[model samples]
Target: MIDLKSAPELKALEPKLNQFFDLAKTKITAIDAEYDNSKGSPVFTVEGKYTTRGWTEWTEGFRYGISVLHFDATGDESSLKSGRDQTVSKMATHVSHIGVHDHGFNNLSTYGNLRRLMLEGRIPDNEWEKNFYELAIKVSGAVQAARWTERQGGGFIHSFNGPHSLFVDTIRSCRILMVAHRLGHVLMGEGDKPINLLERALQHIESTAKYSVFYGEGRDSYDERGRTTHEAIFNTKDGAYRCPNSQQGYTGFSTWTRGQAWAIVGFAEELELLKEFSDEELAPFGGRSEIEAMMLKAATATADHCIENTPVCGIPYWDTGAPKLHLLGDYMDRPADPYNAYEPVDSSAAAISAQGMLRLGHYLMAKGDSAVAEKYIDAGLKMSDSLFAEPYLSTDPKHHGLILHSIYHEPNGWDHKPESGKAAYGESSMWGDYHAMELAVYLQRLIKKAPYYTFFA
Candidate 1:
């Protein structure tokens, strides 16, 4: 479907790929420039804009993922050095505030940093670096186990706030916990405990699959009593436990593009872990067979939903059930006032989803589902290409983000209103740029690997 054999076609697109890479390099440099070591922690903001503003602890993880991709693509010592240096600098502040719940995001990415460093033999012998590394591992392991212990019902409660709140986005967030388990086992030399944690995470994932699947009768779509419809919004308030309601009372609701994307990627990663662990190692935590089956189901359901709902260009509106509306009121509404009522297509979410689907294709191929796997891979590649063609991704100082016209949530009234009074374009955001960079690196790898792996086998 994607024509991986089309070397001529791919070669024809070389210039665009080169341009995308150059743009990515520029963005990485810009992010590095925004780093302030004197602040003691990496600020989420870049050039006066909030990059990691909402959940500040996750910046280290984001940086780690980004840096790893950068190093893999370009042998630039500076990029690698910045990644390690930033980790050290950020950990200084993060370790002091190591709370109970957010550690998954903070530490998961840190583990990525550690894994990369260890593989490259870059672990420093310095007292601070050595101490922090061990401390990070221990703290991360403790937090992960504690979080798992607090699960309620089928899915995990979003955070420590309590049982009734479960955000689908946590699917991606939970990977940090799995990473901790894997890394802990490796670091400690031997033990089945890490395997146990991995199994627990899989259980939580299975529970999520049970409750959050988008199709089939009796599937929990919306809390009819809550007066909201949709899968996008999980809780009524920021930290509350109230269930979300549906829009029309019958169209099982609440499906956010990012949340769906998170589950798609999360399930795929779980499948990878399940395959890597031995059958003997998986017995204590509820056997690898069950986990594999659950992951396959989730991967299929989530990938299907993504393919059906997402635009051909690979961008998705905030929520699948968002009401189609247009701007009609005056432009001078208050910052907090609700105005627009449509789901703004989020390029970042689509990009991440495409990467997840690509990974899923590889996973499927590994299991011998060649034809179906190729379809997934082809769709993902085409989606990536379509997203790349969008002009909003141009890197200009006046542009706030890589892609323009992203909708945060129509119900929330957070559309990207252009600041420059440009009716044709919307506001730029950091999330879009980050995902675009991620997509570039992922596609580069996928393209390189396609020649050797036949999807039609």
Candidate 2:
């Protein structure tokens, strides 16, 4: 389990956070310089260099969004220009992308970050530029919302797999719908019926909470609280949930750590988004108290599971129940060994989950729960400390990836394994790199006493 008792505070981690930003400037610039956009979005590192994979075209935003986030942290105009130019020149398809459940991951990271900067007055408030971004986000959110698969009482934004699949990753993508609703946008359905974006988002959120997350109440033999399935299959005809499944983890019964990380950050961000709405706005769904309680229950359960399951340093293996994990006997008693011959650690999951812990911690504090809040915040800081240093953070200028030891599609044999190691290691993914930057920027803002960072902000 993650050793939260000795975890450092946010103030203590300031120097490392600053160091990470400094290193990020070079890493972001290097990727921008070397990556050939024509090949496709750089998916993950192969032997320390970035490469592409033809998987749903979901990562281009993270590639460009890294630059935008770099500019946000260090005020680098060059990075800003690269991000803005790419968003204009390259991201239109993602805005109208009707095939995938990643609009928030693609659009929010780029256009959303840019719009947040404009709202903060960090950039010149050009009215047209702001509208351009707003329009893009509005379209992106509606397009994402339009990919709905109706269930009994609600529905989900189905994965590219088809109408019957509900991916846990889309929980975070639901942010696009929330943002579009905030901007006074809605999806126009058949016969010019205006569909409420917020309702769609809420339904998707509740569906994920109900179907994707296991609460350990014996839904299945393998069910465990806070254990998240990568995918939930449903019968489209009657909208009946079929079974828990996995695309990247070892099996349907196992918890893919990255999917678990998605749930962590996804629900935490939803809680933060909820703060912006009035009780009246939330009444139609379940009212603010009920909604908050449901989200809080899911958030805390997953976080507690993470703390209990991860190694001492707060990093986890790609999947908790990876078959070979038993080979690394007593693994949880020590720090995660990324170089272990048995199973590789996934720093990318750590990067994403750390932010979730931090945000959930802050949310709890605001609600007058200081003791439990500190545990999550400290666990987040502890994970950040592990990720910003050697073996995880790539210091080699020749390596295009910013963070190392990220795994993608382990079940498909898609990740590159080192020539010498039996397991996959020394790789970084686009989502992994982007979330690490997001985590750094979050802490950087806190350290500098800057405006509190949120996607909506």
Q: What is each predicted model's overall lDDT from 0 to 1?
A: 0.53, 0.91
Following a full C-alpha superposition, what root-mean-square deviation does model 2 have from the true structure? 0.9
Error of 2 at 24 (Å): 1.8
Question: How well does each candidate superpose onto the true structure, as a TM-score?
Answer: 0.74, 0.99
Against the true structure, whose lDDT is highest? 2
What value of lDDT does candidate 1 attain over all alpha carbons?
Answer: 0.53
Tens-place lDDT per residue, model 2, 1-457, is 9988778877887887777778877877787778787898888989877889988889999988999998999899988999999989999999998989999999999999999999999999999999999999999999999999999888999999999999999999999999999999999999999999999998998988998898999999999999999999999999999999999888779889999899999999999988899999999898999999888988998888898899999999999999999999999999999888877789999999999999999999999999999999989988998988888888887788888999998888898877665788888999999999999999988888999999888
What is the per-residue lDDT of model 1 for residues 123-219, given as tens digits with 9 covering 90 to 100?
Answer: 4446565555656755565455445323333335344443444445556655655655665532121453333446556656665665555444443
Best by TM-score: 2
Off by over 4 Å in 2: none
Please give the TM-score that candidate 1 achieves against the real structure: 0.74
Candidate 2 pairs with clashing backbones: none
